[model samples]
Target chain A: DQQVKQNSPSLSVQEGRISILNCDYTNSMFDYFLWYKKYPAEGPTFLISISSIKDKNEDGRFTVFLNKSAKHLSLHIVPSQPGDSAVYFCAAPLDTGANSKLTFGKGITLSVRP
Target chain B: DAMVIQNPRYQVTQFGKPVTLSCSQTLNHNVMYWYQQKSSQAPKLLFHYYDKDFNNEADTPDNFQSRRPNTSFCFLDIRSPGLGDAAMYLCATSGTGDYGYTFGSGTRLTVV
Candidate 1:
């Protein structure tokens, strides 16, 4: 069973515009959510994260909004740049233990057109 | 620069042959994890080591085994590789309480 799901396989947006990627989860025990950006042949780099207690978190051009009641989260990039193109993964922990194991979505490929 | 390092960016092994993938971390993190990622698929957890204790995923195949000799090094041993085992292997590290993990570039394994 896929606990975390990224419904959209890919997204395209014009440069200087906004790009939004959505993710959903069925597990209610997950208290933290994180987004990672990956480029071709490279490892994933941590982007932004949000706790269940907070509805939103932002880092520079990246912002993550979480809705605990709906078990959904979205990542928004404003004024998207061509360099922002990459695969984005949404992940959540299976449990809240000291050694938490993360479960990731299939990932969404984001393309920022110049 | 402290980082997670995975050796042999690429490897080719004959079917039914044994192969070992190595990982090391200079980050001095307490936790290390191994993940297997097939093409166009999400990374799957194989196992992890918290300090000296090793933990394996229930679904991980018995053909796969891991060893952490110390805090700085870990190894994944495939006793008998199959064609379906071809994939990218990732190593990650994190501090005790930190939820954020740093991952290596990953090693691509090909079973011919």
Candidate 2:
């Protein structure tokens, strides 16, 4: 069973506008979450992350909001650029111990239009 | 620059043939991981090496094996490649399992 899920297969947004991507998970013990962006024929790059202890984290134009009680998280990019278009994946891990496996959600493809 | 590198970014192997994919990291991290991503699906972990200890995911096929001779490099061996095994293999490194892991460009395996 997939513990993490990104229901949206793809999304399109106009350039210089805000873009929002959503993700959900079922496991409560997972204390950490990360988002990675990938381009065609390239590896996924680390984007932004947030600890379960906090509700939000921001890095430049990107921000991640987490709702621990709802087991949900969302990634927001302000003034989205064409260069930001790619597949975004959300992943989570339980801890540094044996349950250390990272569960990933199916990626969401974002397209920026001019 | 510190990064993860995969050799022979692309590989073509015939059915029942054996192939090996290599990965090297200059990040000097303590944990390394292997993942298989099919088309648009999420990457699934195949195994990992924590320092000298090796850990394999329970669902990883027996046909697939991994070896980490040293901290700097790791290899994935496919015993008899099948058409269904064609996918992108990714190598990653992390300071700890709880943090964001850096991924390599990935090796695309094409089984003919």
Question: What is the lDDT, from 0 to 100, of the residue A77 in candidate 1?
Answer: 100
**lDDT digits (tens) for residues B3-83 of candidate 1:** 998988999999999999999999899899999998778889999998889899999999999999988999999999999
Candidate 2 lDDT over B9-88, as tens digits, reads 99999999999999999988888899999987989999999998999999999999999999999999999999999999
- Poorly placed runs, candidate 1 (over 4 Å): none
- Which regions of candidate 2 fall more than 4 Å away from where they truly are? A96-99, B96-98
Query: Fraction of the real A/B interface contacts present in each candidate?
Result: 0.47, 0.57
Candidate 1 at residue A47, lDDT?
95
Tens-place lDDT per residue, model 2, A1-114, is 888999999999999999999999999988889999999999999899888889999999999999998999999999899999999999998564433667899999999998
For each candidate, give its TM-score against the true structure: 0.97, 0.96
Give the per-residue Cα lDDT of candidate 1 at B57: 91
